[model samples]
Structures are given as structure tokens and as C-alpha cells.
Target: MKKLLFAALAVFAFSFSNAQDEGGSATSQGTWLIEANTGNAMVGSTAFTFTSQDGESVYNLGLDGGYFISDDLAVRVGLGFGGDSAADTNIFSYRLGAKYYLGGEFPIGVDLTGASIKDAQENPLWLGLQGGYAWFITDHIAIEPGLRYNLSLNEDFTDEGVFQFNIGFTLFL
Candidate 1:
């Protein structure tokens, strides 16, 4: 009877230890996040640039990073660049934002975004809001799909608002 009890207790303790090591919440304080996006919104930022396929060539690239300030909260910044070949237009983009994770998975954020266009008189600015779910594929990797809305602060340069769906890849360190 004593041997059986000892074996059971050992197995239970081992299992508990392994479970604890299986990577706690990625949104926990002190974690770092690096992200990229494939969609309209720039990775890690609220900024969006114009892209069109109306017989002209357009390309954009963006990257962003964040550091958790407290449990489930992070401040992020990102930069993006884009150009239209046919129109001979170039855009430089920037974003600054804060994100909060709900229940450690659902993320919501608000940000400020702006773009400077070559030869353009007015720079476009926007206030952005976004929300999404973080689907963790590994201990440190996540795929996030979200919706974002950017309200144009300078409507003279662009539309009143832009709505987009974005998919983001993230690494939590």
C-alpha cells in the first residue's frame, strides 16, 4: 500500500511541473512582442497606406514591436513605407498605440497614425481602433486576425474613415 501511494504522488507532482512549464500567458508583464501583418493595416500599428491595382504597381511594407508594461497591457510602435509606381507617389507611415489583452487572448487597442506623402501638401492623420483574437500555435508564436477602423483626422487628404481586416503574425519573447 505504501509503495502504491508513493508512485501515484510522484506521477502527480511530475505532471504538475510540466504543466506549469508549458508557457504561461503571452500577455504577461515583461514579455516582448514582434509582429508583422498581411493586410491593409500596417503590422503592429494603426497606420494604413494606399494600395491599388488599377493597372499600376503598388507595394507596402511594415513592422512593429511592443513591450508589456503590465499584465495584459502593451505599448507598441510601427513604421511603414509604400509607393505607387504609376503615379510616382511615395508614402511614409508611422503609428503609436497601446493594446490590452482581455483574458490573455482577446486584444483591443487604440492608436494614432500618420503618413507623409512625397510632394503632398497636407499630411494625413488618423485615430485607429482595433480588436482581435490571438491564436497561439506554439509557446511563443501567435496568429492574430483582427478588424480595424481608422478615422481620418485630416479628411482633406483622404476619406473619412478606412475599415480593414488584418492578419498578423506575432512572436512573444
Candidate 2:
């Protein structure tokens, strides 16, 4: 998990200086955006615990899609897989939501996501909000680093509050 965190940070650092200093407007309406997202929880312990104690890192790989309803607004959906070594758990997660692009030469924005997590014993739901700066490295590619806060709707199989740092790439298609 620590390695995962470091790797993500390294990627962000490597790309940071290369990103154009100029700002850009959001995707235009009718444009399609596809993204590959990777992230894990910001845990207090290292990865080898093999138990849920001291918290565990839960990693996720996902595919996300967005369609601009207008230049400043878009609807999005995602599908993902998640796992944790400490809890010995594997789950399928999905989300549906929207993001309103804050227009600028360099775009920064917030997103509201509603998601579901399902496993063998229980299924839980959460709502998450993320804030980040979108760095357009190219005409069709962007790197987004964001902080997310999730509030669980039920405690049956999850924590009440979850937080994570995420980095993802969006490709305008």
C-alpha cells in the first residue's frame, strides 16, 4: 500500500512540471470522456498485516465514463473492483454521478458521486465528493489528483467515513 501511494505520488510529480501553465475550458457538450482510475485508502499501517486491525489499504481499479451535458456539466458512471489484504476481502464497486467543471484556462473542479459496494456478506452504499485540479497535459489527455471524502449510508459492511487520495487520467474521445 505504501508502495502504491509512493508510485502514484511519483507519477504526479513527474507530470507536474511538464503540464502546461495555461488554463483550458471544460469539455464541450456532446464530447465523451473516458478515464482509467487507480487509488487506495490512506491507511495508517503497512501492507502486510493480514488482518483488519490497524486499518488496511483497499485498492481500486476502475473505468469511468462521462458525457458532457453542456460545457460545464457532465454525467458520469463507473465500474470497479476493490480488495484489501488486511480484511481478506474482495468486492465489486460502482458509481454514478456528475461533475461540474469550474471553467478556467486551467480547470479545477468538484464532483459528487453516489456509489455501491458489494461483497459476500453485505452490500453498502456511500456518497463521495472530491475536489481536484485538472491538468491538461495534451489535447486529449489530463491528469487529475484529488482528495475524496465518502460517507457510508449504512454500517453493515463498511466504515462510516472513508477518505482517499486519487489520481486518474482522462482521455477525450
Candidate 3:
């Protein structure tokens, strides 16, 4: 657990440094976010048992930094901590991804992520892909709705994959 926390902190620190070096503003370049999601198993026979009622609710707190590579494109890196009730699970994740502005105040994008979780007595690593659309309500606030599919890579856990529906609010800076 300590190791995982250390690694997550290290990644966030590195991203912060990079954003600073690039002269990124707190509101335009860096963001703090809060997200909530419900996850269900979508594959195999387990699908039948994975209803919204049986699903787990997860909450996450994270930081994201946008590095503009072009007017409509930006590279984004985010790190977060998450918790869920099904198993009283704790997760730490870091994502390196990109976003594209769709000629509006809001932008739509896709992200691929790698995550680690400690649930009950097991620790597992996961790789996931997600896509979302964000509506920038203001210069510092935005709302995003997304979907995620995650595959577990290591053992000490069950559940082969997770299908998640997410809604998040972000405050830039």
C-alpha cells in the first residue's frame, strides 16, 4: 500500500513539474477533479448478476494537467485515488492520455489508463480504456460523463473486467 501511494505521488509530482516548466496556468493547464461512478461486470456469466443494484459505487479525487500540443489537441496526464463499497476497495491510478477540443467551449476525448487496487486482501493491477465528453461550464469548472472498461492483469483478485459509468466535475486550478 505504501509503495503504491508513493508511486502515485511521484507521478503526480512529475506531471506538476512538467506543467510548470511549460508555463501552464493553474486554470488552463492544471485541474482538480472529483468523480463518481458505478461499475458492473459486463462479460461472461457474471453479466447476469451485475445489475446497477449489485454494482459498486466509486468516488475519485485526482489532478489533471493539459499540455497543449495544438489549438485543438492537448496531452493530458492524471493521477487519482478511488474507493468503492463492494469490497471496501482502495485504488490508485495514473493515466497518460489526450483530449481534443471539438470546436466548442467543451471538448471530447478518449483515455487509456493503468490502475492498481487493493481490495479486501488482494491487490491487482488493471488496464482500462475510456471515452468521454466534457462540457466546460466556466473557465474553471467542467462536467464530464464517460464510460470505462477495465481488465485485470494480476491475480490476488477476481472479476475479469469492469464496465463503469462515470460522471465527474472538475475545477481547474
Candidate 4:
């Protein structure tokens, strides 16, 4: 998983950096954005997990994409797969959301996320809220650092909410 993460980052770094083109605004209407997003890359959270856990080794891989329906407002969708090594469980995750870019830099978003754990009957769902700043490295790429909160909606699955710090790589087109 670590190797895969490193490889993905390398690909993004090389491809995004090399594909730079002059652009107008990243948040304009009809623009599309694709992101490689990870939570707790530097600090906060135990794993890239949406459910509550106590020090379990976990790894997640996900992609998010959005299309601007209007200037500064985008509708997005995401899909992810992860696992808990301790529990020997594989999890499938999904997210649906909207993000509004403030002045095409600061972004605030709300999302619905859920994870289905293998061999478990209960699927945990969460309401996720995040705020971040997009620091554009080029006209078409940005590195986003953010704070996120995942509020667990199902107490029977997970009673506690998750707070995560995230670093994201985005390609704007």
C-alpha cells in the first residue's frame, strides 16, 4: 500500500508538473477537476478511514472528480477502496458532494460518505465537511491542504466521529 501510494504521488507529480498550460480560471463554469486525495497524510487520524478504530493498520486509495455546474460551484463524486490489516477486512467506500470555491482559492465542501466492511453486516455512513485552501502551482494544478470532519450517522456501526487533516493533489482542466 505504501509503495502504491508513493507510485501514485510520483505519477501525479511528474504528469501534472509537465502538463502545465496557460489557463484562465480553474473554477470557471464547465471546468473539470480531478483529484488524488488523502486524509491524515502529515498528521491527525489513525488511518485513512471513515469509521472509528483503535490503532489498526489501514491503507486507502481514492479519486475524486468534479464538474463545475456554475462558476465556483462544483458537483463531485468519489470512490475508494481500503483495508484494515488487523481485522483482515476489506472496505469499499463512496462519496457524493459539492464544493464551492471562494474566490477560486479557498474551498468549502459538504459530502456524504459511506463504507461497507467485508463480512460485516453494518455499513457506516458519515456526513463530511471540509475547508481548504488551494495553492496553485501552475494554472492547471494545485496542492490543497485541508481539515475534515466525518460525523458518523450510525451509532451501531461507529459511535465516534473522525477528524482528519488532508493533503490533496488536483489537476484542473
CA-only RMSD, every prediction: 12.8, 6.7, 10.1, 4.3
Local distance difference test scores for all models: 0.74, 0.59, 0.52, 0.77
lDDT of 4 by residue, 67-151 (tens): 9999989998888888767879887788889999999999999988887778997888888899999998877778889998989
Name the candidate, 1 or 2, with the larger TM-score value: 1
Task: For candidate 3, write residues 1-173 as lDDT tens digits.
Answer: 43664465445444443333334432343443323222343221111112234576545555565665655566777666666677686667676666665653445555555556674455555566666776665444456677766676555565576777755444443
**Runs of candidate 1 exceeding 4 Å displacement:** 1-24, 41-54
Clashing pairs in 4: none
Task: Tell me how candidate 2 scores on lDDT.
Answer: 0.59
Candidate 2: tens digits of C-alpha lDDT, residues 83-120: 67676776566677787667622333334333333445
Error of 2 at 68 (Å): 0.5
Cα TM-score per model: 0.79, 0.65, 0.47, 0.82
Report residue 119 deviation for candidate 1 (angstroms).
0.6
lDDT string, candidate 1, 1-173, tens digits: 43664365345434433232335577788888877666663322322334557787666777778999999999999888887798698888888999898888898989898888888889888898989999977556677899988888886877668787887767777
Worst lDDT run of 10 residues, candidate 2, spans 42-51
Q: Find the 10 residues in a row with the least total lDDT in model 1.
A: 41-50
